[model samples]
Target chain A: MITFENIDVVYPNGFKGLSNVNLQINKGEFVAIVGLSGAGKSTLIRTVNGLVPFTSGTLTVGDVVVDPRSKAKLRRLRSRVGMIFQSFNLVTRVSVLNNVLVGRSADTPTWRSLLGWYRAEDKELAFQSLERVGIVDKAYMRAASLSGGQQQRVAIARVLAQDPEVILADEPVASLDPPTAHKVMRDLRRIQQELGITTIVNMHHLDLARSYADRVIGMRAGEVVFDGPVEEATDEVIEQVYQRSLTAEDIVTAEATQE
Target chain B: MVTTSTAERRAAPQAATVRPEPPRPSGLVYLGLAGLAVLAFIVFWVIQESGDVLLIPLGFVTLWAPLNPVIGLVVMLVALAVCFKARIGTMAAFGALAFIMMSYWAGATVGFTLLEIPERWSNVEPRLMAFLDPNWSYIWTVRDQWLITISMAVVATLVGCAIGLVLAMYASPVSSPNKGTSQTIKAVNSVIRSIPDVGWALLFVAFIGGTAHGLGPMAGILALLMFNIGIVAKLTSETIDAVNPGPVEAADASGATLTQRNRLAILPQVLPGFVSYGLYVFELNIRASAALGIVGVGGIGSAMMLQLNRFQFENVAAILIALIVVVLLVDMFSMYIRRKLL
Candidate 1:
């Protein structure tokens, strides 16, 4: 279980990223946090792994308390909580198999990883992760050689190799096309279900959130305005959270149809 | 219809005949023009004061030589013509003027005179002839020294590159453990690079003794090694600084330790650049090692110095030909490797 208690994040520049955010997320639940660009969706998801330290609040992920003050504790918490980015940030110069093995770095000894001496079990787990993403054939290929969709899949494999208790995806499909975005979302949803890991995704596409998430949390500015089951998040409720009426650009499918 | 359209276009310009004024040159341009005038006056005064007299100063000896006034006047005239005709910005015009002045001053200080070449030609003829018909037997005599030079360069480059890789990691801002370390390494590297190869050779020879003590090649290799470390560390650190931050962020997010992150995320990206720099530094070391020999360190240069001291121009010419061929071959080989790697 993950919980945020009265979270308030004020940046050094005096911008409030999150204010008084309180929520409880159960294990195995696929929650999508949707908002406009500066609505703190990414910031909220990052707080779970202590990537974006909250200014004043207590956060707990599984049994670990998120504390930025403790470097070792934060690293330990990050190891158990995998995060994926929109840009699919893999070291393109290296092989796909090596990129996946980076996911096992936290578990391995520092000297061992530095020397690239992965144990047999770690290699097995990496290959299995690659197999899960259906990119086992490209494991030896350089990451730069793969297409955008394939690279994103490799990033997913890297996350899967971590075998984390929770997953945080920040705008994972923002750089991808509509079809590829849906495919990646489906992969995340399937993996979350199979592993029974709590998944928190930050998305701008309302339709994608509704399609994949069991629960939808809507944020405006720096506050969560609406939190309910996907079925209850109607157009009016979404407009209230956005503080503006929806446009065709707000829906991924609608934008695709226009194209 | 075409004529009508042309007439309409012509009339449209007359209808808006109130054109905007062209912008005026700033006060800085006028200031530059004044500066140029002052510079021209200074040059004229210098020529007037130093008319037709050149002094060549050798160590503890001074020789009086003749300077041709016509050459100085012509050079000045051409500089002035270029400054006026080029119609360049004030800074560029001043740069041209400064370049001309410096060249003239340098020539004067060196006692350059066209009249001396013909007057001295007879003295140089025998030596030139000896160089043309080099002593072929001299090759066997200096062959070992040439090999020693090549060996010194190879050892220095290999060891320097290995050590430089580690130093670069600390020097680069992106991969450094702390800002203080990065700054300190950069400052030290700059100081090392500032010392010339010959300067390093002299310092080492003074401290470690010379060829009499049988440590000539050792001094030469140490000099080249220091130079190589400075260059390779600087270049590789710059390459490291330019690596993409995206992968670094991803590694940090994966909870990898700092050492693991740099080894995996940063090293692969900078490896190609580092290897290319290594090959380039090796080429430089080969050239520098030959020069180090002149400072009493054992190499082909030492053999050439010995032959020159003995007035054996033919022997020196042979060493020169062989050294040129060797340097060219090394250059081509290093280029080929760099091309293949990059």
Candidate 2:
């Protein structure tokens, strides 16, 4: 379980990234965080991994407390909490298999990883993870040659290799086309179900969030405006989160169907 | 097998459209060609018969042993043909005239000076042979100093590159742990870069060699180290700055420690550039080591100086040949490594 109580994140430059944010997510649940640009969605996701340090808050991931001051503790927490990015940030010049193996760095010995030497078991796990993502055939290919959706799958395989308890995806499908976005969303949903891992995705498209997530958390400015089951997160609730009427672009399927 | 004329075989395409033929040169082009040819012939005739005509160029033509009329005519015709084919008729005519005229005037005065080379070589041959008469004895005796030169460069390159890599990592703002560390490293890099290799060599020689009179190789090694640091730091730091930040972010998101992030994310991105710069600095150090020897900092440069000062051309030549061979071998090796890395 992950819990946040009165979390306030203020940048060194005096910009408040998160303010009085309080939330609790249960184990093995799929939740989607939705908001406009600069609405603290990324900040909330990053804070779980200690990438964004909270100024005044008590946040807990699984059993350990989130403390950015303690590097050792942060690494320990990050090991069990895997995060995926919108850019699918695999080292493009490297092989697909090697990019996925980067997730195993937390487990692999420093010296062994430094020397590009992974144990047979680590390689086997990496290959299995790739197989699960349906990109086992592209394991040897360079990450740069793969399309954006394929690259995002490689990134998913990377997270799977880590075997994390919770997965945080910050705008995972923001860079992909509509069809590809749905494909990736299905992959995430299926993976969450299969592994019984807690999945939190920051989504731009409201329709995708409603379609994929069991629960939805809405944010505005630096505060959470609504948090409820997907059935309760109506079109009016989402419109209130953005403080505006919904446009065709706000619905993923609306634009996708028009095409 | 069947054969058809190209035009006949492609007649169907030609029947579709009547394409206009390219325009041929006008009568004015032929007139210009004729006029250029006549001018060239006149110049050729004048160059050949100037000696008899008592023309102004006769004085220049008589300066050297004049070319035979037949050879002169052949050369003029060949020159004209080449010039006209290249469409430089008027310019070519003027150029040919000026060249012939200048050569005759200059060669006449300079011709006798060339004879001195053979005369001087004959007198110097025995002296040169007498120096090499010992059959590589001098080279063997100086083997210890040569080893000093070679070993100093090797050690300096290895140590300097190691230090430089660390300095470069911290100097890059993108990969640096903090702004203060990056700024401090960059300042140190600039200070080191400002010092010339020879200046560093001279300073080390004066400072370190004051008490130890024979530690010239030590001075050379230290100087080469400074040069390597400056070069490698500047090159690798820029390379680090230019590296893609995506992998670095991914590494962070995966919970990699700072060391792991830098080693796996940052280093691999810039490793090729780092290796290439390291090899380049090594090649530079080899050449600079020789230069350092001239200022009493030990290397082949000092040996070459000693030989030249004593008029030992044969030994000087041998040292030069050794330097060339070593440099060439290093150059080929560096090229191979760079090709593989890049």
Candidate 3:
């Protein structure tokens, strides 16, 4: 379980990223946070793993109080929580297997990781992760050689190799085309269902969120405006969350058709 | 109303056709021309009086004659005409004129004269003939010294590249643990790179007591090693700084420590660049070690200097050919490795 109690994040530059936010996420729940640009969706999700530390208030992830000040605590927390980025973030010069093996870095010995001597079990895990993502054939190829969609799948394999309990995806499909976006979303959804990992994704595509999320959290201007099941998040609630009426641009399917 | 306006426009063109005035050179151009003329007069006065002319040593060569003023006058006039006629920008025309004048001034200061080469040819005829008939047997004598030089280059380049790779990691802004560490490493690297290879060799030779003390190769090795470290660290750090930050962020987010992050995310990206620089430094070390012997550090260069002192031009020529062949072979080998790696 993850809980945030009156969390506030004020950047060093004095920009308020999140203000007095309270949230409770249960285990095995797939939640999608939706907002317009600068609506604090990414900031809210990043706080779970302490990537963006909350200036005040207490955060609890899996029964441990999240403390950004303690390096050991933060590392332990981050080890159990996997984060994905808009960019695939794989080292393009290395083989896909090597990139996936990086997910095992926290568990491997420092000397072993430095020397690139992975244990046999860890290598097997990496190959299994790649198999899960259906990119096993490209495991030895450089990450730069893959297409965008293939690279995203490789990123998913990397996360799977980490074996985290909670997966936080920040705009995972924002850089992909519509069809590829849906495929990646489907992969995330399938993995969430199969492994029962608590997955929270930040996205701008309302249709993808509504289609995949069991619960939807709407954020606007550093505040959570809406939180409920997908059925209750109607157009009116979404418009209120966005502070504007929806357009074709807000829906991935609609925008894809216009193109 | 449109028809009437069209008729008026047609009649307006027939009234008068005045051509616009052609653009004239700016005042800055004339000022630059006047400055060049003044500089020319100073040059002429210096050449005539032969005063305040710095004669830089060009080995056995000397100045042949004073520059002719008529040639200088013709070149200046032609430059001034082009500046005015081309109507280029003031800055560009001034820059061109200033560059030409600076070249002439530098040449005159250095006492550069093409005619001196032919005039002194007779003096070099004996050496040329001796060089053409090189003593092939001299190679057996200096073969060990040549080996020492090549070995010094190989060891220095390899060991220096290893240390340099680590220092480069600490020096780069992206891979460094903190800003203070990065800046300190960069400052030290700059200090090391500022001194030339020969200067380092001389310092070591002075401290270690030269070849007579049986430590000449050690001095040469130390000098080349320092030079290699300076060059490789600076270049590899620049490559490290330009690596993709995305993988670094990913590693951090995966809970990897600093060392782990650098090893997994940073090293692979810069490995090719580091190896390429290592090979290049090896090539440079080969050539540099050949000259360190002049400062009393033992190598093929010391042997060559000894031959030159004893007036054995033929043996010097033989050693030169061998050095050239070895350098060419190393160059080819390095290029092949770089092509395969990159």
Candidate 4:
């Protein structure tokens, strides 16, 4: 379970990244947080992995309380909850398999991993994870050579290879085209369902959240303005949360184009 | 009328709502100041060196001829300044040219007024040595000396680099990971670097003198090794510091232990730096080994000093050229590897 109870994140430079972000995500839940730029969606997700330290807040991932002040605890927590980013974040020069194997570093003995001697079982696990994401064929290919959608898939495989219980994806499809974005979201949703891992995805497209998420979270000005089941998250509620006039044209256009 | 108004509004430009003054030409003032300053210096320097002539065969060259040594001389001066600033190549070529043109002729003129050893000594090989010099058997006699010194240089370089590399890894900010250990390693490296190679040779000669059969070459090789280690480490650290933190972070977050992260994540990224730094140190050590010979460590440097003392300039020429050839070849290889890295 990942929970943020009145979490307040003030960056050292005095930027209020997340303010009173009270939210909860249960195990095996597929929740999507939607917001425009600077809306605290990323900050909320990053809290789970302890990457972005909240200045004042209570964030619990599983049983561990994330406190950036405690480096060791943060590192231990990071090893459990795998993260995927917009940029793919795989080493550009390394091969796809090597990139996936890095996900195993959290579990391997330090010296054996250091000496490039990953256990045989770890290698088998890496291959199996690649197969799950439909990229086992590109195992030896350089991560840089793959297309954008392929790269995102490779990143998913890397997290899959981690065998992480919860995955946090921050704008995972923002850099991708619409078709590729849909495929990646579908893949993430399918994988999360199959693994029964609690998955939280930060998304920009309203249709993506509606299509893939069991629950939708809408944030505005560093606070959750709307949180409910997909069925209850109506156009009026989205309009209130976004503080923009939602139109019938938007719904019609979004639906038509996604076809 | 309404449709035309809408089209006009669209044509008016989205950006026309605000116009920012093109960023002021702030760079021009600096350029103008620099140009004026350069002009002033030329005028002032010309006035200072008024008596020295800068004669150019401008008219003759305009008339039609290829060899304009004056223009060539100007090119030479500019190239020398650039080489001095950037160190474009080995210094030997410039040093040799200076000796041939300036030192040989100018010193002979001074020697004419000073010690006056006949105008003809000119480091010329005399007929006596040419006729009496030993042939094939002499090389066979000295083969053991050559082999041992060559083998010692190789062993010393590898052994020294192994120790140096381990130390460098610890001394590097990347390897230490923490600030305190990194600072301590830097202090030790600085102390090691301050002792000059010659001082090392002299100290070793005093304690570990050629008491053992081949200790003379051993001592020279060791000093070269120590100095080159410092040079390699200093050159290599920047690459280590500049290593992409993303991969390392990925490895770390994956639960990689520090050693595993370095080997799996860090080493692959830094391989190019290692290759280039290793070759650069190898070249430096070669030249250094020759210098080490002067402190009773056996090599061409000692041989040159011996010939200089005996006034046997011909033998010195042969040895200097051989050493230059070796240095140049190594320099070429280093250049090739560096090009590949970039």
Which prediction has the highest lDDT against the true structure? 3
Interface RMSD of each: 0.9, 1.1, 0.8, 2.1
- The TM-score of candidate 2 is 0.70
Clashing residue pairs in candidate 1 are none
Cα lDDT tens digits for candidate 2, B176-266 = 8889999999999999999999999989998999114888888888989999999998999999898888888888878777767777788
Query: Which stretches of model 4 miss by more than 4 angstroms?
Result: A232-259, B1-175, B187-214, B298-300, B332-342
Question: Candidate 3's residue-wise lDDT over A138-246, tens digit each?
Answer: 9999999999989999888888899999999999999999888988888899999999999999999899999999999999989999999999999999999998999
TM-score of model 3 (first chain only) = 0.97
List of clashing residue pairs for candidate 2? none
Ranking by TM-score: 3, 1, 4, 2
lDDT tens readout by residue for model 3, B143-242: 8998899899989999999999999999999999899999999999999999999999999999987898999899999999999999999999999999
Q: Model 1: per-residue lDDT, tens digit, B5-86?
A: 7678888888767987544435466455556655654665566545565666798998764454445545655655565555
Reference-based lDDT, residue B181, model 1: 96
Query: Residue B151 in candidate 4 has what lDDT?
Result: 63
Clashes of each: 0, 0, 0, 5
Q: Which portions of model 3 show Cα errors greater than 4 Å?
A: A12-14, A254-259, B1-80, B101-115
Best by DockQ: 1
What are the per-model DockQ values?
A: 0.71, 0.46, 0.69, 0.36
Error of 1 at B56 (Å): 20
Candidate 2 docking: what grade?
A: acceptable
